[model samples]
Target: MPLKLYKRGKVWWISGTVHGQAVRESTRTHDKEVAEAIRVKKEAGLVSDHVFGPKATRTFAQAVESYLKAGGDARFIGGLDDGLLCHFYDTPLKDIQQNDLDDAARKLYPTAQPETRNRQCYTPFVAVWNHAVKNGWADVRQWSRPKKPKGTNVVRITKRRAGTFPVEYEHAARFIAAMSPGPAMLMTTLFYTGMRPIELFALEAGEVNVTGRWISLYKTKTGEPRGIPMHEFLVPIFTSLLKRPGLDKEPRLFRTPRGEPYEQIATDEEGRGGGGLKSAINGARRRSGIKDIAPYTGRHSCSTGLVVAGVHPHIKDQILGHAADDMSRHYTHVPQAPLIEAINKLPVPDAWHALPWLEDPLAWSGRLAEGTGRRTDLEKRREA
Candidate 1:
């Protein structure tokens, strides 16, 4: 009915089936009392989900599967899960070792960018495994994570182009000014409001209150909708952009040039889907002759800028939909206004200025300008 007891070689064993599957196993105990206790714990786990419901007993896989399925066939399981699944799923959890993790890390090291692979692949798997351990699906001691190599050496650093800010917000006014009318306005909003691009992309026309000087962002990374006070610098610009015809009726405030509503900007089943806004900053960098600055750099520029501007880190994290200050380095809202202010406060290109250029702009520019002839040529052509 529950568990049957047996004795083999002077050791007592308690065995039973779990979830209709035979799960007979040695209790590995010399004492019958110990064997009985083990049997009770295992049997309790088996029926807990049925009697107490899902909150009482779901496996790691079950929970992850549920989370993935809830987003209407769209989900953001960490990239680590994909990497771990690719390399480790074939083996039992107990077999995973430092060597196994190292091999997996090396496999990813050669091909994938550290940040991308770490976030998308490594992080997810660790999270999934930890989730499993938490739910008693796997032993915590058996779980291992790739020992991420320290320092920036392993990373593929894309140098920014000359005359561009090494950091996105270093030349905030100019970056926004250089953007085409549509993207420029959006950039201005992104910089000031520090809203994640997705959160902004997911905005409704009525979400912004021009008079109230605030915007409510739904579907934020935090899984909660937060109303952020619109910076005074952003209100007029967003108001003007929102006033543009044909944009007001869209379900989402942001759209592609072709007028499609913004969707998740990730590669899906059919390959990387439409709405290039996810990589909009890269596109901007290409346009602005900046190199290697990602959409995330905008976010980094925002937080770092706020830090410089003396905005409280907690407040900055709250603004960026980031749960913690340290994790903000991973992904957070980019504050355009403060970042720009920080950039501008850096001594201007001319040496006569009192403030030292936050960095040597010329040196930063020179580093970025390397091997960017096509970019230079394009800029020249545009000026002509």
Candidate 2:
């Protein structure tokens, strides 16, 4: 084939075979004339390489090393990725066919949810391979990254209700009312801010700005700096928490439940991730007998509450550190008044409308739990 010229994301590229292996490269030009010139040169090079031996092909392992050397691991989130790449470690990128990629996926993620396999396996595999492609070793057009393994028709919506239970605003209020001071405060922050558990743990006292009416943050899993405006109600809470004795000791802001690092409960009982926040949430859920309650439910509850209350989506994204424009919104200077106003519009759940008080949302703690919500006496009796 006369080296096939294609455009990907505005950059023109030439695709063809060199020594029986697929190779493609960006022409770095928008003008078709310029692209055509680049394609001709690439085709000439491909012919030369085909007649002789082609450039040395890189293994998937070397691609991973290049990626890591470029500090890619810090940029994306995933574990068990190295194991996925191990399947093709020794094989040359040029020799890797779609079948080889498929076999790896089927073996490593056979019975894992297709989405899980895609993210945990194929996602990393492509990232590693892309590093090679950028260096003129592999091809994106050849063996494509499998976003979902073959024959997996359904994108299972069994969207894990795992490790968390939803909390309505009133239920949150009651849960807070019933909880110890430390847990109460912690849950309150989660409920209002929709901040992640790790972000909560990473909060420094200096990050909170009562005078500026915003909380600036840099320590996030996304590795992006954020400036979340403080809600009106949270100002007093922040003021109180900021002034509490021994606040200066830890680098992080609110060491609620005092002295213990947030991850202790996560480590001992609740398992890794979310740290003591997860344990504290579960403990409070049990203490209050609030079904399906966990730390993350607080974030969702806050988001749902805002949405239901007719708050602007952009405002919600801003408050929760979610950029609708995906990091671009982070840089746009939005006035605090509008943010606070949108927050004020977020309706608190009435006493009669509170969950657990009114109803139980689903609970899928991911640990093969019983039924979802509350069951009646006759229903329970029938099961017995």
Candidate 3:
């Protein structure tokens, strides 16, 4: 018999026979709308394969549980889970084919200005299907994704390393100044040091050697602890934050308004989880009237400033934590004095004023919006 939905108390349940064996389960929902969706998914999953016969059928949720449990990097695993499960909840592992996935991609963030479908959508959906097939929990014909159409841009954000561009120093100074204390400090820190936003997020009070005037990152994206000499400009910021009452030597160096640690690159289930720090930058950008400024804009600018200030290439690597401590190669260790001196030489725009959220962001926003904003290839876009 085909699957049938029957009420159990106030909720609903499904029962059916697959390959001559009776299977039954609760929809666990009181609402008609939710129950109907669950009913469809259960029915699809339980139907004995007319072709393959009694092969086991796995629900999308079951496959996802397996994937999350077999963890590697938490961010990648969590990202895939969180991004995919909402779209495919209670879906039958076998029902979705490649064409369906392609259709689903079209609907996500369709109205986004750049038209990038959520690229993260790819992992959970694909990974779950593969895991199910590998484990004998599901058997379905392999499905291949269709070719991406022209002009549909999707950026899959993993842990960030490099940045796309530098915000002009004049624009940066004005933008940072208009932000609140927490974000203004963050923005300045990013610009002066080529630290990845995640690196900053993972920083702690104890890691900062106040007496030695260096910061040690015991946790980093590359699974290595790195030490960076603190810039004189950053000293006051760290000092002020560390002095917050009841904050211990080991507390997170940077925090949000609630005193929770700021977002880090990626820790094993700690910090802001990823988006909080970026959100702060975007929020500050709106208030500062700066267009196209982001958290990463500072890192790019900082590196550029070092290059412009004639810092040696090898020394720059150490300061930015990009140097590899490889076994076979001899690497020159950069000392504190020159690195600090080089950072002090890094240029700041003449327009820097006090960072107190004093400027009207709308004024700067308006100026940019009035055709002063960076334009794409207008002629090429018109042709497209």
Q: How do all models score by TM-score?
A: 0.54, 0.56, 0.50
**In candidate 2, what residue range of length 10 has the lowest lDDT sum?**
360-369
Candidate 1 vs candidate 2: which has greater TM-score?
A: 2
Ranking by TM-score: 2, 1, 3
Residues 1-384, candidate 3: write the lDDT tens digits: 776778889998877775565868787889867887887766665554443532345556677787656541234333333445656666676676676676666555455333234323454466666667767767756555434456649655544332356756777887765454465666677788777777787676677765555776656554455667677766666766666655564477666534556754442211134446655555555655665666767777877878887889877887787775753123222236766777776666655544322133211211211121352222232356
Instruction: Please provide the root mean square deviation of candidate 1 (C-alpha atoms, Å).
Output: 14.3
Alpha-carbon runs more than 4 Å astray in model 1: 1-48, 51-57, 72-82, 85-117, 126-170, 244-249, 266-274, 278-287, 324-384
Query: What would the per-residue lDDT of candidate 2 be over residues 1-384, giving only the tens digit for each residue?
Result: 567888898888888875566777788888899999878766775676566433344666667777777644422222345465556776777787778777887887788766556656666676676666767776665445555445668554554453243456766676554444455566667777777766777787878888766777766544456767666666666776676555677656555444444542211111235565555555556656764556666677777878887888887887777773455445434337776676665455553233221121111111111221242332343366
Error of 2 at 49 (Å): 21
lDDT of 3 at 311: 88
Local accuracy of candidate 1 as per-residue lDDT tens digits, 1-384: 577788989887766666674667788889988988888877786677557554435543454554354431233342334644445544544455557655766675567655545555555556555555544555665444435478866774575432223254545554443333344445455556666655666777677776766565556544445656576555545555565457645556554444456565532212133245435445566656655443344555566667776776666766666643354433323333443333233222221222121123221112112124333422443356
Look at candidate 1 and tell me the lDDT of residue 219: 63
